[model samples]
Target: MYQPLAYRLRPKTLEDIVGQEHLVGPGKIIRRMVEANLLSSMILYGPPGTGKTSIASAIAGSTSFAFRMLNAATDTKKDLQIVAEEAKMSGTVILLLDEVHRLDKTKQDFLLPHLENGRIILIGATTENPYISINPAIRSRTQIFEVHPLTPEAIEMALDRALTAKDGFKDEDVILEQSAKRELAFVTNGDLRSALNALELAVRSTPKNEDGTILITKEIIQECTQQKGFSHDKNGDAHYDVISAFQKSIRGSDADAALHYLARLIEAGDLISICRRLLVIGYEDIGLANPAAASRTLDAVLAAERLGLPEARIPLSVAVLDLCLSPKSNSAYQSLDRALQDVKNGKATTIPNHLKDSHYKGAAALGRGLTYQYPHEFSDGWVAQQYLPDPLAHTRYYEPKFTGRYEQALAKRYEELHQKKSSSTK
Candidate 1:
């Protein structure tokens, strides 16, 4: 059973690590802790394959501590007990708990004391934000450091290491062209594991010459990775970046760029994410200007969900196109934020007595709904009335954009009503 290239080529020492200079670099927090042998319980937070596990393994390598790993979901209390017993005699056990955020109550309670003291030096790795997912008690005890996506330069370094290292392809007699190498780095985005796997696929699948010299070109690399070769890392930065691009492109009304990003996500085959993002873009960016477009986008998303992949992309693309071509207006989004901000800042205003609910047992004796005119009784079905809080009575919140007919109509109606109210007051 051969290990995956990423696993086999994992850095044995902290120095061999590829990225995350903020943590692993000389004099950084991790390096300093390692140097002083004061390694404390900590959490390595980041996107997958950004070297969280590798860093944990490297810590054991560097410190000569007994290393043991267990999945938070599957490992039993008995298994943890075994590690604890081993640690008591072996000095300290470096425990690498994958998906530590998923740790159950039984195991969590058992590990608490061990983690608090020096018996079990815990290194938990999670792709999800620990602050949101992990137990607060456990979180408070450990130092948290974020592992960022590998830069292209760092990915290139990892590739070079894989090609030349003894544990990697050093003895394979393969010639990877510089252009091909760069393509692998670029296609993998910031995921070195993805690059290594693609490299492994290219090297193993492609034929060698009579002399056993394997020549890997950019075309061969592309073929191995299926050309698109992207590692979206679902919850990662790349995923967020694509979503951001899809939204901004549509908001800027650049149908071409928006479609390109749509194709990228479609190629990734994440219908759920694509569907969710499309709906958000429709409402947040194309609101007011094309309110109906948001509903249509929802319809398209439903269609895509039912149809699934390739076929689903059609409806998604339709929604994307409609949103891009529609008049763009973020005014509604801004207005809501402004009103919410005022509320958050403690700008208190009591609800007007006239507007208070009058349907309750309390009658006109308390003047709960006094002077509240019923607009429906008026011939025009309109009346000059104050519905806002007393302090906010004259504080206008909605500023409809004039880019579309619906909002422009709203603006006009609002202006007329305000003018009439003002004249009546005078």
Candidate 2:
């Protein structure tokens, strides 16, 4: 069998693991569990290629326990029965179940008794959200640890280890340039497996020179992965991930990283998605920080749509950079959500009679707008009156976050306009 480079170069021990320090680092939960040889059933959850299976394999090797691998998708109850029988024959079993959330109710039910008796130590790996997809009974038996995505630096470290490992290309005279390494790391989007696979393809496919040294370049890496490390399906999980990263980078004020993902989206010919997501990031994430920025981003998005692909990126990038450098606040979205939640939970009450629509005929006859106070007649166009329903007359939802100059002014005005006696004095 031609094993992939990622599998061959998988981290064999807990110490060898590169990313996910929260779980595997010294004094961390998983590492401490391994050091004491006190293994328990664990369900590792995260995106693909984030080392969930690798960690399970590392635990089995370190503990000297008999390791068995199974896929929930293909394996049946009968296969699990065999594993259980093996656990009885042997001392203990470390079962690495990949895509474990797919295991049906019957298999999950069978797993509980074995887990309780400590006959089989289950190490399930899944890309889906385990809490939502996995059987609750299975979750109750296992410690759930979410594996975070590897950073570019972590991915690059894995690539380097593969290039020099004894089981890897250590014997081969491979010349990987620095630029190629960075590009590969950036393009993989924190997926170490993708990085190793791309490197393997690039190295094996490239022609050797007269000196028998295989040279790997930036172009070669791009050719293998396609479109300069922008291997994204517009409709896939990767597309959502990149868009999320892009928006978060901008919110974090990391202009360079934001621009990099923006470029990636453009390369994938996903201009419309980018434009739409940028609008959301501007208003939702960058809300109240610079209110003008949201409208400006909308204008920029319109321009990008009008200009189209090749040149559309120009305006889109401008908006991304602006949003990246701009201050960020989610107060608007959060406050609106608070109000929405209250309404959804039956907090919505009758509209104040004075504040009802009175422009229509006979609205006054119903005493709808009779007692309404005109704010313009009061000083500074500000009159303290009930605008919300009677049940929520004093409920304040939209509180301004003093982030940017614009929101700072809003904060002061909001405080003055709302602070008053228990009831409206008007």
Candidate 2 local lDDT, 1-426, one digit each (tens): 899998997777998898999999989999999999898999998777889989988998898789999999998889999999999999799999998888888888888899999999999998777777888889999999999879999988888888899978999999899999999989887788888899999999999999999999999999988844445667545677888898888889999999999988998999888988999999887888898889999999999999999999988988988898888889988999999999999998888899889999999899998988898998788667778888887788987777798888888877777665333564
Pairs in clash, predicted candidate 2: none
Candidate 1 C-alpha error for residue 74, in Å: 2.9
Per-residue lDDT, model 2, residue 406, is 82
lDDT of 1 by residue, 1-426 (tens): 989999998777899999999998999999898889989999998877789999999888899799999999888999999999999899899999998888999999999999877899999998877878899989999999889878888898888888898889999998999999889888876777888999999999989999999999999998887756554556544676788898889989999999999888887777888898888888899888879999999999999999998899889888999999999888898998989998998876788788878887865677889889999999989888888777777888888789999889878998988899999878
lDDT for each candidate structure: 0.88, 0.88
Candidate that would win on TM-score:
1
Task: Show the colliding residue pairs in model 1.
Answer: none
- Residue 57: error of model 1 in Å? 2.5
The regions of model 2 sitting more than 4 angstroms off are 1-22, 45-50, 104-106, 128-137, 146-241, 252-257, 268-273, 285-293, 302-310, 322-335, 341-395, 400-426
Clashes of each: 0, 0
**TM-score for each candidate, following the candidate numbering:** 0.77, 0.69
Candidate 1 off by > 4 Å: 1-8, 149-153, 169-172, 179-190, 194-228, 231-245, 252-257, 295-312, 325-327, 330-370, 376-381, 389-395, 399-409
